[model samples]
Target: MGSITVSGVGKAYKFYSSRWARLAEWLSPFHKRRHTLKWVLQDINVSIGQGESVGVLGVNGAGKSTLLKMITGTTQPTTGSISINGRMAALLELGMGFHPDFTGRQNVFMAGQLLGYQAGEIAELMPEIEAFAEIGDYIDQPVRVYSSGMQVRLAFSVATMKKPDILIVDEALSVGDAYFQAKCFQRINNFRQNGTTLLLVSHSPGDVVKHCDRAILLKGGRVAMDSSSREVTNRYLDELFGKPDEAPADAEASIPTDSAAAHGLSQHDDVFHSRPGYHPSEHRWGHGGASIIDFLVSTPDASYPSRIESNTQTEFYFTVRFDSDFDQVVPGFLLKTLEGIFLYGTNSYLSSRGTAHHSAQAGSVQTYRFSMPMALNEGHYLVSFGISSGDPRQDLVPLDRRYDSVLIHVGRDVQFWGIADLRATYQQLNA
Candidate 1:
C-alpha cells in the first residue's frame, strides 16, 4: 500500500514590483492586477509504497525543493492535494527549525517537541543524540556560535532519533564531514530496514544509485520520468550535458543504452561496448598550451568498459591530437582524485628518450595506453592527458582536457582511502 499519495499537486507564486503596484491596481477600477505568476510545480502525481525509498533528481530551479516543501506542509500547493499516511519528519534545509539563539541542547528539545516528542522522551534520548552529533561542549553553546556543520549534525541527530514514518531529506547529508555522512547513510539504511519510507533529494547520482530503488526526475516543474534509479539518473545526466542519448526503457534488459553506452559503439546484444577509437568531448584548456581528446577507460578485452568492479585490471586510453607537432613530444596522462588532486602521472618523454625526437602529426591522433593497476581505491576519479614539447612553456599543444573522463568504483574489498590502493604487506614484528 502507498504510504503517501500526491495527486495533481501544483504550486504557483505571483511576483509584484512592490506594494505600490498593488495599490495602483486597486486605485484604478479599469486596470487589472498586473502580476507575473511563476508556476513552481504543476500536475505532479506520485504514489510511494510503504518502506519505499524514492529519490528526486533535477537541476537547479527545477522545483525539487519546492515539491518537498509542499509535501512537508512547510508550504501549501496552489492546487491539488497531498495525503501523507503517517507522522513525517523533514530536513528540507540545514537547521530549518532551529533557533539561532538557542543552544544545541536547547534546540534538540525544541525540534523534538515540534516533532511531537514529549520532554521526558527528549531527555531520555539526549545522550544518544549528543553522541551521534559529536559536537562536544559546543552543544551547550548557542547555535549562533556553531559552524554550519555543527548545526546540521545537531538537527540530523534530533530528527532521526524518533524515526518518523516518513523521512524527507534534501541535500542535508552533504553538510557533514565524510565520516559523519557515512554515519548518516548507515542510520538511513537502518531506518529503511525497519520499514521507514524515505524521500531523498540530491544532485549526486551515486547517492540515488546506492540508496534508492526508484527515482523521480523533475524538469520545468513537471514529472519528466519516474522509473528505476539507474534509468532516471542516466536520463538526468544526459539532459544535464545536452547529450542527446536515450536510456533504454527497460534498463534491466540485456542491452545497455545509458550514458556509458553512448560514448562507445555496441556490438553484442547481451553487453554493449564502446568502439575502438579514442573519442573525448566536453573539452577545456589547462595550464600552458595543452588539450585532451578521446580519453576513455576500457578493459583489455572488452570493447567499451566504463563501469568496473573493485580491484579489477583495466586499460586507460586516450589520444592527444596536438595543435602543432613539436620537436620533443612529451605525452603523458594524469590520474586525479575526485577533489582534483593529482594522484599520479607519467609521460612518455620523461620515461625514456625513445620517443622524444618523434614529433606528433598535427590533426592526427596520437594514442597512449597505460595498464591501470588494480590499486585504485574506489570512488570517482578522472583521467587527464596532455602533450608538451621541450620545456612546458616553450612549445606545446594540449590536445585533450576533460573532467570526469572515467568513472571508477572501488568496491568494499579495499579498506583504505586515498588516491592509490597500495597493496602493502603488513608484517607484525614479534617483540
Candidate 2:
C-alpha cells in the first residue's frame, strides 16, 4: 500500500493591493476589484509507497516546501487530492510546534500530541527523547532560552520518537554539531531498516545519497525530473549553477507565438536557473601578482566531465598564463568544499623539495596536470589554483588566484569520508 499519494496537485496564492488601496475601495464602494493569482505549483503528481524513502530536490523558492506542506496536510492545495496512510510526523521547521515561552519539556508533550501520540505514550518515550536531546536541565527551561542547536536536538528527538509511519523532514539536518548529526543519521537509518517511509528535502547531495532511494527535482514549481538520487542531484546542480544568461536549448522554442509572452517566459526561465550553485570564478581571493588564465576538470578522453562518481580517479587540468615572468615562481592548487573547507592542496615548490622556479615570458601559458584521488563526500567543491613566489615565511608574490577554477561533484558509494577511499574491509562479531 502507498504511504502517500498526491494527484494533479496545484497550489496558488492571491495577490492583492495594499491595505490603503483596499480601504480606498471600501470607501468608494464601486471600485472594481483588482487582484492577481500567482500559481506556486501546478500539476504535481507523485506517489510514495510504504517504507519508501524519497527526496525532493530544488533550488530556493522552487516550492519544495510548499509541496511538503501540502502533503503533510498543513496547507491545502488549490486543486487535486492527497491521501496519506497511517500517522505522519513532520519536522518542517525548527521549533515549528514549539512555544518560545514554554519549557522544552512542555513543548515536547505538545508536539508529541500534535503528532498523534497520547500523553501517556509520550511520557513512556520521554527518557529516550531526553537522552537523545542531551540538553540536561535546559530541557526544563523555556525554548527561547535554548540555543539553535539545542532546539534542533529537542525537535528532532520528539519528531523521531513518535515513530510515525510517514516522516517528512525539510532541511532539519543542516543544523546541529557533527556528532548529533551523525546520531540523526543513525536514527534515520534505523527508520529505513524498520520500513518507515521518509520524505526528505535537502540541498546536501550526500544526505540524499545516503537516505533516499529515489529523488524528484522541482523546477519553476513543476516536476522537472524524477529518477535515482544521483541523477536528480546532478540535474539539480546543473540547473543551480548553470549560466544565468544561457537558457535551456528548448526554452526559446517552447515559448508561445506571442512575442511578449515568449519574452516573458524566457526571462522567467533565466531567473529560475540563475540561482547560485558552485560556480568557478565566484571565489574572492587576495590580490595577486599573477592571475589564473584557465582551469578545468576533464576526463581521460579530454572531455569536460560535469558530474563525478565516488571512489573514482579523475584528472584536473589547469593552465596559468603569466602576464609577466618572475624568478622563483611557485604554482599550486587547492580543492575546497563549496562552504570553503579545504580538502586538499599541493604546490610544486612544496613537493619539489626545493624552490620550484620558473621564469615565464610575458603572456606565456604554463600548464600543470595532476591526477588526484577523488575521495570527496558527494557534494559540490571548488578548485582554486594560483601561483606565488618569494619567502615562505615572509611576503610572497601571488601571480594569479582563481577562486573557482572548477566544480567537482563527489558522489556517494559504499564508502566513507576522506581524501582517498582505500576500500577497507571489516568483519562483524557475533554474540
Best by TM-score: 2
After TM-score superposition, the amount by which residue 352's alpha carbon in candidate 2 deviates from its true location, in angstroms, is 4.5
Best by lDDT: 2
Per-residue lDDT for 1-431 in model 1, tens only?
Answer: 32889999999998878978877877888878777789999999999989999999999999999999999888999999999998888888999888889889999998999999999999999999999999999999989998889888988998898777888999988988888888998999998898899999998777887889999999999999999997897677656543335433322232222343343422223111222222234245555433443544555433233334556666665555555655666677676666778788777755554544446655544556565665665455656556566654355554334544554443333246555667778999999
- TM-score on alpha carbons, each prediction: 0.76, 0.79
The lDDT per prediction is: 0.72, 0.74
- Model 2, TM vs. native: 0.79
Residue-by-residue lDDT tens digits, candidate 2, 1-431:
33999999999996767767666655776776666679999999998999999999999989999999999888999999999987787888988989999999899999998887899999999999999999999999999999888999999999999566888999877888878988987888888788889999998877887789999999999999999997887677677656333544433332123232222222112131122233535654645545554443544432234466765566554555566656666777788876778878887766666655566666655666566667666566877767776654467677566666566666665546555556678999999
Candidate 2 residue 69 C-alpha distance from true site, Å = 1.0
